[model samples]
Target chain A: MNEKVAKLYQERLNRYMTALDCGKPDKVPVSFGIGDWIVKHTENNFQEIFYDWEKSIKAVDDILPEFDVDVFGGGPTLWWPPMWDAIGSKLYKFPGMGLDENSTFQFVEEEYMKAEDYDAFIANPTEWIATTYLPRISTEFENPSSLRGISALIRSSVAFAEYNNYMGASWGKWTVEHGVVGQFTGMTKAPFDTLGDALRSMKGILLDLRRRPEKVAAACEVIVPHNINYALSGAGADTRFPCFAPLHRGSYPFLNPYQWENYYWPSFKAVIEGLWAKGKRTYFYAEGDWTPYLEKIAELPDKSIVFDIDLTDAKKAKEILGGRFCLIGGMPTTLLTYGTPEKVKEQVKRSIDELAGDGGFILGAGGVVMGDAKKENIMAMLEAAREYGTY
Target chain B: MSEKEKKFVPEPGTCTPWKVKMEELGGIPGNEEIVKKDWERLDETAYNFLWFWVHR
Candidate 1:
């Protein structure tokens, strides 16, 4: 790294963490919420990068230099199609393997785990995961996941290690080289979200919650430690990159307080606390409307967590989270796709007024850049922040 | 190039649903108009709501 480039990276990193410390830096920090939009922006389709890591980096390089975002959220971490195809990922569809060559990789949700399997799941998760879950989810993993004997275990273990080495090395190179402070260490999910998203479809989980609450709760317990362990051990030791735990199913319009409190909050909070004990902080992309749960959110360690909120009014979130947490986003994606440059500025001004008030705010869209977002508006989104957001 | 295709989330949550040709997923028959209107309606609601939030 050039001396100046490294210094610039550290300066940008410091500016971001300072806001997280609830201090006003020289200016407001803005982080990019990238997606396949960059692929389309660079005159390519999703299939190009979905198939190759180098292409994904090219897509990042094509557009990232245009804007100076304080944090790079590892723009487009493409999955290893071979690994998912082997494991029988219940939630993914990639190019040519399942969809057309030019098609964007998609997530397919199905109820893979049945109610009766709760016993099998709670019995020996590691064994059950290798034998039952793997094969049931992916066609190729059947023979490997059987673990009928030691040879089978060795085959699957070696296969998994190779897959891990491939995906981990590529993703790490992109995140470390591109990420300023560090890349988000790894992704985490609320154990219930994991259960809902993968094992059970959203509908399946909702019904299970109503029909067999205890089984689902018990299943969630078995998965919590795994989430914590992965977050802590999945990446480099003592890295500044906080593992991101995106709360999707727990967001508003999806759960009642009774359901959220009993099922989601405790386990998710435990995982955060678990990482916290290891000196790890978490960056939560509380997707969708989380205004209803801001009070519950305020209970976590002050300044140790950064909350990137969506849909919730920032002024109200700040009031509830006053000095108890740092806030990252409030600019809605709507403003970027349809609003004019002036409109984008106005929203940035409002975010400054609301979230950037006590110096805990970093201005950004609540979610990823819309794959169809207007180029002019995206530029405006950044420009407005720099102009009005200077502290 | 269909107007219905113009606005359907076709996939999960992003705006460029057409980025993937969703022919395999097929269409929800009654949703054509609902999507067209909502596409315009939601965009308008969001922009209008934001326009007011900033000015207010």
Candidate 2:
């Protein structure tokens, strides 16, 4: 890094680190991502941005100079479509392939892992995932012994490695050029989410809770270690930043208090505790209302998580988790989509007043800002964060 | 594979443990540390690849 870039990087990193530790800094650190929303502003459509790494990075490069934030969340797209294509994976329907080019990708949730496979999965999770889950999910890998299946495996593995390398290089370039600090190092999921979201589908898991509750709990128990390992491995064991865990199913009304306490929170909390033991913190990206579970979530190790507030009551979160843990997210994502720029600024001021008063709070959109989110509203939020976000 | 070997479950974050591989190789005449290090790295990659499918 150049001298100028290094200085900027340190300034941003220190600000971010301070806020993460629940300490007051010179200013409230701002986190922003070039979500799919950026595609609408760019000359290129969703496909090019999702498929081409250069185009994805370029999309961010164009915006980074203007987006003066402490942390750079990420680029326009999450995955390279070609990698999904290579595996013949039925996980998602990418733009231009299954959906219109202008539209964002959609996850194709299914009971990829059947009910009968529970015993096999619980018996040996990794082996079952390799031998059974891969073949079931990837059409090309249906017959792993076959030449086509083996080839698909090779191609997908190569693509996975390449994608990781490209992302690292892209982040490096962004840091050198714009002096951006990334929000999180690695990614993981709650163990129940690992089962429900991908393996069982929401419907399937709900049924299992009624009929095969023990199996569900057992499977999740088996997953706790793997989740910790995956987070560490994916992050290259970096403890400097939290591992991103986009929590689902654990949110309110998804599971009742009884079911959540029995099946969900145990394994999920175990994963968090496990990561914390390894000197890692979890970016608890609570997507929906977690108002009901705030007290239960507080049971986690102090500073072991940076709790995100979306539909969760902000005051309750601050009253409960504030000072002990860093609180992020204040501007509701829907406001960015429909509200005017002035309204966004109003929300920003209110958020800073309510949440950032003490410290341990970062200003950002509450959740993933969709493609329809207005640029004016986003720019307003970024501008207003600086305008009001001071110690 | 033998009956006992068939029942062996690999540890988490590993597809095949180096001990298992070492058993298969009987013993390494050369630098065992070098071979084990490279083997574990590849093993880790394989483990990540397996978990990658479900993680999505």
Candidate 3:
């Protein structure tokens, strides 16, 4: 990196690190993401951004110069569809392949792991995943010993490695050129989500909770260690940045407080504690209303998480989680999509006022901004964050 | 393979650990660290691959 870029990088990194530690910096750090919302602004379609690595970086490159933010969360296109296609994977329907070119990817959730398989999974989770889960999820891998199934595994694994290499290089370029500090190093999930998302599906997990509660708990307990390991391994054991944990099922209404406390919170808390033990903090991406569970979440160690406020009550979050943890997100994602630029700026000002009083706050949109989110609104948000974010 | 052999569960973050592989290989004649390093790297890659499905 050049001397100028290095200085800029240090400034941004210090700003992010300061806010994360719940300490006041010279200014309130801002977190910005290049979501699918950027597609409308660019000439490239969703398919191109999702499939071609170069195009994805270029799309982000086109916008980085314009937006001045402390941390870049990353682009909307999370996966390379060709890897899924290589295995004839039925996981997601990406744009151009299954939907229109302009459309976003869709996850096809199913009960890939049957209820009966709980014991097997608990006994030997990794082996069970390799032997049973792979065959069930990928069409080509139905018969693993068969030539097609074997080849599919090889092709997809190669694609996974290829994508990782490309992303690592892209991130390096972004940091060197744009002096943009990355949002998080590694990725993980709540242990319940590790099962409830792709393996059991929402309906299946809920059914298991009623009929086979003990089994559900056991499965989640088994997932706890693995989730910690995954988070650490995924980040290459980097503790400098927090690991992204897009928490699911722990939010309100998804699980009654009783079910959440028993089945979800134990294993989820274990994962966070395990990461903390290893000197890693989790980026708690709480996407929905978690007002009911604020006290339980606060049980975590100080500075163990960067709490995200999406649909949750922001003022209450500040009141409860304010001084203890770094609080991010205040502008509601809906306001970005439906509200005007004027409203966006207002929300930014309001979020900063309510959340950034004490030093532990980063101004950002609450949750994933969708394709319909307006570019003008996003720009307004970034501009306003700077205008009002000064401490 | 016996039922006991079939139930050789690997540790978390590993599919076939170096210890398990070393046991399977009986004994290594060459430098073990070199082989172990590559083995663990690939094991991590495979672990990431398996976990990728659910994380999505």
lDDT string, candidate 1, A329-389, tens digits: 8678887777888888888888787778668788878866656677777788788888888
Residue ranges of candidate 2 with Cα displaced over 4 Å: B1-6
Worst 10 residues of 1 chain A by lDDT: A145-154
Candidate 2 per-residue lDDT, tens place, A213-269, comes to: 999999999999999999999999899999999989999899989999999999999
* Candidate numbers, best TM-score first, in rank order: 2, 3, 1
Whichever of 2 and 3 has more lDDT, that candidate is 2
Give the CA lDDT, 0 to 100, for residue A300 in model 1: 86
Residue pairs with colliding backbones in model 1 are: A88-A138
Residue range A1-391, candidate 3, lDDT tens digits: 9999899899999999999999999888999889988887777899988888778888889889898989998866888899999998898899999889889999888899999999999999998899899899999888999999999999999999998888789889999999999999989899899899999999999999999999999999999999999999989879999999998888889998889999999999999999999999999999889999999999999999999999998989999899999999988989999999999998888888878997989988888889999888899999998899888
Q: Report, for candidate 2, the interface RMSD.
A: 0.7
Steric clash pairs (candidate 2): none
**Candidate 1: fraction of native contacts reproduced:** 0.00
Residues B1-56 of candidate 1: C-alpha lDDT, one tens digit per residue:
56544323211112233224345346556656656556643433332221111111
**Clash pairs detected, candidate 3:** none
Which is better, 1 or 2, measured by lDDT? 2
Error of 1 at A7 (Å): 1.5
